[model samples]
Target chain A: MLEKANDWSDTFYDKWKPIAMGFVNGAEKCLQCGKCTGQCPAAAVNPSYNPRKIIYDLVNGNIKRVLSSVELWQCFFCSGCFATCPVDINFPFFVFMLRLGAMSQGFGWEDVKQLEKYAEKDYLQDGITVSPEERNPYVIEERGDIADIRQKAGMPRQREVSDEAIAEINMISDLSGMTNFMKKIGGVELYDCSKCTPKIEEKCKSKELPKKVGNVKTHYRFYNYGVPIGGADNA
Target chain B: MHKLDKLSGIREEIVADIPIPEEIFYFQSCVASNKYPGIESCTLDVLNKLGVKPFVSEDQTCCGGFVTFANVAAPTASMPAVARNISLAEEEGLDICAVCNGCWTFLNEFGHFMNGNDEVKESVNMMLNMMGREYKGESNIFHIGAMLYKLKDRIAENVERPLEGLKFATHYGCHYLGGGKYGAIDDAQHPSFIQELVEIMGGENVDYTASGECCGTGFTQVINDKEKSLDHSQMKLESVRDEADPDFVIVLCPYCLSQLDRMQQQLDYRRDVKLDIPIIHITQLAGLALGLPKERLAFDAHIGGQDRFKKALNKIGIDY
Candidate 1:
């Protein structure tokens, strides 16, 4: 571990100050007790993904290595580690900040481009992220069916966001630099069903063919680690 | 010692007995309103039956959590949006009652962030000024599950349909219990609030080994990393199936409901794993106990375990 500190610099702490601010007391507060790794759902599934190691690297000023690693994108942000941490490190917040750092450095665009599409098409247009009408035909039809059921149930067809509220939402998105970030990441290109073969088009329409982006390997099936009862002593 | 002392104080405040409010601003969720509208309706129905008046506002939009958690943007980018939504509740002079865990946790965490960082709060307030709104961090955000847990006795008194002879397994989801920074109403590691509510509703609680694990919706993970996402859900489902074959699983978040319900079918098709347990939001179960009709519960919207759920309801002499 000491040998891994060769890349450390005098200005390292100051350079990575923003990311360290995400943690409760800075990443150096991590006790390195391995308790967080024990409770991490991502670590249980993927041996290569360790929260303790991430904290260690951050504390040792390995910003480039930590930001460039594929493991940075694998955290579920479940906050299980935070819940069990003795010092309350808030690992999810730290990981979220690290992901932002990774994004600014152009490391994890493929992992988040689909999200970019959702932000552009759904959130920007409707002020909501999961608007089924903005999705494929199958989802649109399913949403319609849900509306009919809601009507039969004597509930409103849908929750209404006033035009004023939606306009304000769009303004907030723009003013907060969210719209700029989406554009900076390269706006999602619309998928043309006409260009695909009939079979592929059908699958594409159903959103089953064009797979999601990411390269995180999960072994949840083979690894049957019984419930992770967390504590440093348990670790 | 300083951090631990502060946390312990927060924990004490969390565990203190507080009065349940009679009225609250109902914060809407994107997934619940679009995909599972029943969860929204059931939330209102149960709240009404409990003599709680929930003010549903048309001026509110999505919680903007999916954007941040999905990695589409940073937390700071969504701070203004979160402040704007919470400001609506503040304007009403009422606490917030959120039906979805994502909305509940996001609102609270973001509110906590703004309260601590004056500069960030000032900037967020400046952004909100464009809409003639400001976030004072005045309203307390509470999940409907926590509200229901606090009103367990009231719930028991209004049980028109007792869930007798039914066994329920619960998935608390990650955001509500684990993502809380200030602390939660119950112990995060060993929570029994749901089980206590199950008992009050005349249902038996089934214990599973992986009760505390995440459902693995992971926002974007389900879309981008389907295999890994489904694998996490598969682990929880298999544990519940092998340990205790509950009649249905109860969840607090709409995202967890979608992931656990829809992914069971995916697992059946992909891995041939036969875990056909029905998944229902806590409000849906509360709706049934309050004697709401089957159509109002909207079990039809679910992708898996509807038939099994119908059979279980039939055994209790209730028509599906």
Candidate 2:
């Protein structure tokens, strides 16, 4: 159950001021119409991941709980909610900001660590994120074959980023604080999952989760809210 | 004001004017260039055939959008990279034409952020100044999908082989349509631009219920929560199969193309259903209609549905 707001606090709102001051008034215009929840693809598959409730919590100043919860990370950034939003709230961007806030508070670091292995490593080296050199053997072979096919098709074997461009990208990554933030988060301890639901705990203990999810291999634990709220089930 | 009145006012603000450029910077995508080079090549071929000059620069780097979307970095962290990339296009004095939805949406969204936030713009420009570049925000970023839609008439005129007797279902992808407030070319809720393109190419447009649904290549979700991601794709593909059994599923973005095309094999194994639908990029579709060789379209890069695509072509009596 959502915690009732006996006394509203602007502390959380003040920390993320740009959200409120900027686009769509930071969910202030939300009419609780539940249109965003209805249109969300993530919510459809995961009953625990509720966009409407997240926005409601944000509006009611239930920041601490929302930021730390696993529901914050469930959004795939599809922007379906934004398209269906009556007032055009841009829920994906809102979720993006919320994820950032969660990260700052030492939550969702495991997910970022996974990204470091899959994307950031290659992105830092080459100007591209998912380069074939660092991928699995299948991908490397497939990419090499594609390169051959591209050559036959009259295109370059692969996109060539100039040495100067690579240097510029490296510099931008450094100067923009990405390098430092990554290095800082690298040493930070993972978010404690013990506080999460028993379902996630069981999945973690039973070790039934696949070593590889989709394309990349990860030990990241997926979470679920304890129960369905108001019996809402889109699946 | 009434709720409907407010909604229309907001819609009026975001419905962007479509501009047809004679030349575009042609921002290349990492995924398309690596996994599916055909999308890049086909986009170039189709655009050139439609009289749009595509200039690709070696100086431009990745948009670094994956880092942000993957939850590795904040949008501000990639702002400098985004600025630098757009500055490269601005330096050429041409608008950007991104073949992939990720490239255009990241450029446009981050570009919009930098445009609105003076502090962010100043900081990002400061970093770019170190590289002897500055983002002027003059160039407008356009997806090749929108550009193709704008040149539908020209495409219709140059159709050497109309895609007759072929049925196509369209997937506009999430970023191209759902990346909000950018004044998308079509209605985000009920987008029919790709369907319209298919019809113009002499193909039948098959309607499906999950046309507006995501393809489930959620940058990190596909990696972290694979079940949910695949479940979403399964739902969409099943809908396309059951409701509209088209010869091909047309998509605008390479990410969507890769997800929907590659996942059919996974879905076939996970479920008892066999959805052997060939997923084709709109540019590739246009390239086919414009009489480009099948090799140039590079259908070989795709994983599943090759046999079905060939059978469909054989049925249509169209030989490359």
Candidate 3:
């Protein structure tokens, strides 16, 4: 665990506080109630993530741990906390704003950028967000199998998002700054320190970053129930 | 006009108990089209039976909910995209029936944002005007579940198979229930819309501990923290497995369907549990009740516990 000092100057609250003030009124009316955490699904699974504690941390200027913590990324955005908050605190919105602040510093979760390729492909391939083309060979094959099943059931074998819609999506994305945001955040430039050696900084410099941005810990496709139809026989 | 009035006006539309639209600008979900092809077709089929004409434009894009929720796309970008989508629907002069939960909620939230904030709406409209489109904020946004709830009586009267003897647990998809308090279909804290539908379809609606919990399709967790994401899903399923022991988990959103369907295999392998419960979308189940043929519903597209689901249907004496 990277030990971040609790210095307020080290936090991005200067930029974020204004946004929070606008939206949540600086959590000013927060009753120190633990209802947000109590109802939080993320906190239910991961004990470290507490919505109430996050608001407490923000109000107290202890934003260091809140910004850099992986727990920040763990929010399911279910808004269970938002719905349960006595003070009507919008915790999900707060988390989203906090994420933006963190991202402005290039310090938030980078894994979100993984979906950028899929969103880009949505424009080219019509509107299938997770097309078979982008998936691993196994997923592609599984998708083909599933399509075949649909076809056998007398359903249409083809479904494409509109080409015009894709054009519209591109134009809107470009016009609205989504495309640029994705490009900026999607680039892979971070080193997983957990994988670093004794000479961590030196090892990081020498290490070659993976070409694709993705979840390093999991396969591209969600786990399929059936036999592996593509890729290596063993895989 | 005050912003509060604008906000309340939008809220009034959302919470209004309006008649189901005769025609809808049916927005396609990228996830539904890819992950579960049946949801789209089944929805179309069910809507057709309900006497609703769905205008599925080839000129419509994904709602960009997943991308936005991933924090890869900011609202400044996505909100305009949403406004553009609405503008397209506005051009068609039809209210939007977002079949996916994520799309429904995000569009609703962005709709509120664009409506309440005049400056943002103006900028988005200015961008839309370039495309020869405009968003009036007059059209109502509805989730498919809400639409189904609206037509529950019609659905009940039309059931051909009558899913008696089948047990179902409803996963309303947190986006619609827990996304926010604004204009939810039913009581978010105790949503009974889908459960009511299950009963109308002649199936037993079972309630579990994590009924309102997320399926762990947490946009970020699905990308980076796969283990933690799967853990959250597993916990929900385990609660369902232990308490409800449902034959099939009913889902309104394709993403939630995928999470419940695809992750079951991972959970069974990881936790060494025998959860043979299958997951089906609400539209698919409704399609079944409406006497749609088995082949038309594309049951094989589902990933887990197909045999068990088939057997359950068999036990219910549903030949199709």
Please tell me which predicted candidate would have the highest DockQ against the true structure.
2
Better of 1 and 3 by DockQ: 1
Model 2 has an lDDT value of 0.74
Say which prediction, candidate 2 or candidate 3, comes out ahead on lDDT. Answer: 2
* Chain B TM-score, one value per candidate, order as shown: 0.93, 0.92, 0.91
Q: Order of candidates by lDDT, top first?
A: 1, 2, 3
Candidates, ranked, DockQ:
2, 1, 3
Q: lDDT at A45 for candidate 1?
A: 60
- Angstrom error of the Cα, residue B122, model 2: value is 2.1
lDDT of 1 by residue, A73-168 (tens): 778878888888888788887777777666555555656776787788877777778875533344344434667877887878866778898888
The predicted structure with the larger DockQ, 1 or 2, is 2
| TM-score of predicted structure 2, chain A | 0.74
- All DockQ scores: 0.38, 0.46, 0.35
The TM-score measured for candidate 1 stands at 0.86
Model 1 residue B123 CA deviation in Å? 1.5
Candidate 1 Cα RMSD after full superposition onto the native fold (Å): 8.2
TM-score of each: 0.86, 0.87, 0.84
The best-first sequence of candidates by TM-score reads 2, 1, 3
User: Where's the lowest-lDDT run of ten residues in candidate 2 chain B?
Assistant: B1-10
Best by TM-score: 2
Which ranges in model 3 have alpha carbons more than 4 Å from their true place? A1-26, A123-125, A132-144, A153-155, A185-235, B1-16, B318-320
lDDT of 2 by residue, B1-320 (tens): 11322332223223346567788898988878877878888888998999988998998777887887776666666778898999998988999888887887888888887898888789888888887999988988887877887888899899987888888888988887778445577677766667667778888877888888889877678777777788888888889889988889988888888889878877776766688888988888998889888778888777767678788877755552
